[model samples]
Target: MLPPDFTLLQVVPELETGGAEQTTIDVARAVIDAGGKALVATRGGRMTARLEADGGRLAQMPVQSKNPLVMLGNAARLVDLIRNEGVSLVHARSRAPAFSALWAAQTTKTPFVATYHGVYKAGSGLKRWYNAVMTRGDLVIANSDYTRDHVLAEHHLDPDKVVAIPRGIDLDRFNPSWITPDRLSELRDSWGIAPDDPRTRFLLAGRLTRLKGHMTIIEAAARLKAQARNDFQILFVGDDQGRTGYGEELAKAVSDAGLADRISIVGHCDDMPAAYLLADIAILPTTVPESFGRAAVEPQAMGRPVIASNHGGTTETVAEGVTGWLVPPENAEAWAKAMERAIDIGAAKRTEMGLTGMNRTRQLYRVDAMCAATLAAYERVLDARRLTGKRP
Candidate 1:
């Protein structure tokens, strides 16, 4: 549904590996498949080569800078690019880059779009004003209904201008059948779990941060141990992201609770599909609400039951008693109880739940579906511009 020779320019702070960066690449690939040009302007990162491989050209810009003068300069540079490259629309995925994109789009009389990817904490007036740039687009894309509602409540905007598009999972990459037993065994061996170990493995996959509830999961592990439930292992699979002090604190907590053997903080995993296959259950015990809980969905796509906190986007993605269970946020006892329930459900029932989750994710949260819907949104924006005589 792309226009002839259309060029869509997407701006983000960096091309790092995250949901936004991945989505940008996915959209870029989609644009190329649809016979359109895709341009990405960002401070280069690990995924820059991948973006280029997908037929998206990278424009180096200091869009990540928050300095007002730098942002103004970025705006001028973007305006020049919009004019010279014939960029059809400017789509921004982060607040800092969005400010410059907004100015450039307005100056060039081009359609501007923004995606709300996080529930940014706007604790002060100045911060709130800065965050408000996301809502100033010709059309605003919210990654989840929770994010959409948050945007509407926190900012004054026309309801029609906002659309909720949940982040999607790549099923082909997450399929259980594609994950060989040898891969699972290798990961299990690396994680210190015996291949034939009968203990239920609970995996928490995300950045090892306080907000991600690593401590909460550790506390829950302690409670499970106190309840004489020893036939289980809690694996924290993620990078600490330079939070050495916090990581040390969690290690100390595990030691203090006598869970050093039962709980292990396994640093960053690059092969998540194998990791999910190795786990009996996955958990997203986030203390803070997620704008869109990809941690919850990706495991489910791999036929693993997810135990997510009962808040934010998880509430929308997890079907309680069906695909997964939702426990109260930051409540260790509740999480412990849910873990017990998941273990008690036995292998067959957990398989049933996992199948249900896989089915639900396929129907609602496939990457192809998300990309198609986004392309449709872009088409709508272009159509509106044409009808209103804003574009010839």
Candidate 2:
């Protein structure tokens, strides 16, 4: 729980999408539930209503703007907001907003925190400096152990200051038992899955990007087809995020491989819990390491075994042969073998793996646990500030 006077403000680009945005909303609810004030400064998005409904105050601002002058103006405005609202701590989720928030926090002498939400590419010194703002916090939160190691290697911050807090999933929402038959039927109908279809369903959920390894799945499907292993359906369920070229390219790959019937690029899905239920196994073949693979944990929460890339956060989330399988990243042959192994295991074995994953997920990655840990981090920073009369 937080002190009554603790007014935590989280600055993010927007609440439109992605894990960071969802975490902002989840932490905001946690703050309110703990009897503390929660404030979010952003450009506002579809999720703003959800934030406000949970008693989190919204200070609409142009924090998402990366223009130099706009960021300076945002810093001044944030300084005013902090002074006028008696903000206790500033937590920033992204770089552009962190620059502005860092200035305001320094101006107000408030404790500042930042989360390294992604493994950003820093090819240039300028980009490295820009990314360094995330490390400039009094305490930096890395979303996974992999991310934590990356942060330390790249930034060389004090070992004690950077905390590895894995991303948490909403177990209740993702739970299989909570998914009614009607929900399953609806999604099956919408996605054109027949009630008596005997094909094993595989889900590869992520944005349509080269980094997500969609083409790997397509290639694997083609390999499966070559062996006449045609008893599986692979669904690519995710938004393109306006990357139409990649989407078209994926479609062409499927067609060129003659696996069009086996592969379907179903766009963004709002009902993921049900989607996971519809599939026997979930796949996260991200070409790069996910800072924290939420996609892996979520399907596990739904009691569906996963086959993720053998790198990144999946190394921590997926329990290899226990909960799921982790093949070499972007290796189409490895992915094909993994998918074949999953198929050969049969539904009973897959269910057993899924059950193991579900139990592990419940123990390690629930929203409440994440919220509590985050709030405790906030408390530690605050207590340090009060005791030392300086930022932690």
Per-residue lDDT of candidate 2, residues 1-392 (tens digit): 56888898999998876789989999999988888889999998878999999999999999999999999999999999999989999999999999999999999999999999999889999999999999887899999999999999998888999999889998878988888999999988888889999999999988788999998888888888989887999999987776699999998988899987889888888889999999999999999989998999999999999999998889999998999999998789999999999999999999999999999999999899899899999998999988997656
TM-score of each: 0.94, 0.96
Clashes of 2: 0
TM-score of 1: 0.94
RMSD, each candidate, Å? 2.1, 1.5
lDDT of 1 by residue, 285-361 (tens): 99999899988999999998999999999999999999999999999889989999999989999999999999999
Indicate the worst ten consecutive residues by lDDT in candidate 2.
383-392
Please report, in order, the local distance difference test score of every candidate based on alpha carbons: 0.89, 0.92
Model 2 alpha-carbon drift over 4 Å, by segment: none
TM-score computed on alpha carbons, candidate 2: 0.96
